[model samples]
Target: MRRLTAHERALWARVAASVKPLPGREVPKLPAVPTPAPAPAPVQPPAKAALAPGLPRRPTAPTTKPKPPHPLGASLDGSWDRQIARGRLAPDRIIDLHGHTVATAHGVLASAIVAGDGARVILVITGKGRPDRPARIRDELMHWLERPDLRPHVASLRNAHPRHGGSGAFYIILRRPK
Candidate 1:
């Protein structure tokens, strides 16, 4: 395990000190943070050879995933949107993608839609991701819905009411299976 810095240790101690233990349980001991290893000696870089005038350098990896592509499927009317936003529309089914990996969520979502049968409204919780981090589930949801497997069942995707998790969740209106 990586060692905690002096500042982190001190802060952890303060927070631990302030918390009350359960009625019969004693305060847990603090984990021992390992000290950082010594830095390696700096190595000099090899001299760079001049490149021919025209070729471009390789592109760097992207730091963040791109936002969802254009909307697809039937766009629900405004009344439907407002019904969801106001919390009046109850979902016939609900699926939570929080804490799941992309592949796992994809499988689960596919299975959910296939099994929904006659269910009309479905609530899917993708979890509002951290401001500092990318929202993998939310970002991938559009792509998932666009897939041929799940696309047929999804009539539309609408943002859930604030009470239902606001931007963290969606209302999946399904097309009635013939």
Candidate 2:
């Protein structure tokens, strides 16, 4: 393999600075390039502090609020909304994950998604939690779906209707396979 050029080494230095090394591992640093001392700039007289006549001062950037994640059904079209509202749409595949632990559920969901059988809509059932504590599986389902490989396959996620297990179930609308 050829040695990295100066440009490649410089790019690597920038990349290395941004990463967090694993425990007991150190990030390899690039050799420092010695910059030559600059020639002295000529001294100049100070100008008036007041702005030049008719020149408008630029406005400072506005502070933006962090928007919440988009609502589950927002991106879906009217037909999807109508079917979901009327509880008329039937799921093509049903993956019941009520009893599985986090790791097992994650693997199953990934495998099912990757090895899809042309399912347009999948109903995922995560059992409702006890009155005192929220269910871990239910909470983590969204997080799992957000993985890079799965997110593209999924179009939108909606809470299932009462007939379809209500809040304990989620309707995963898959994008039409191209």
Cα lDDT tens digits for candidate 2, 126-156: 8789888678899998888888878878788
Q: lDDT score, residue 67, model 2?
A: 83
Cα lDDT tens digits for candidate 1, 1-178: 9977877887888899999999999989987655657779999898977778897877889999897734653467778867875799998888998789999998988888889677888899999888897789999998999898888888888888988878999888888778
Q: lDDT per prediction? A: 0.84, 0.84
How does each model score on TM-score?
A: 0.57, 0.59
Model 1 clash pairs are none
Give the local distance difference test score of model 2: 0.84
Q: Candidate 2: give the clashing pairs.
A: none
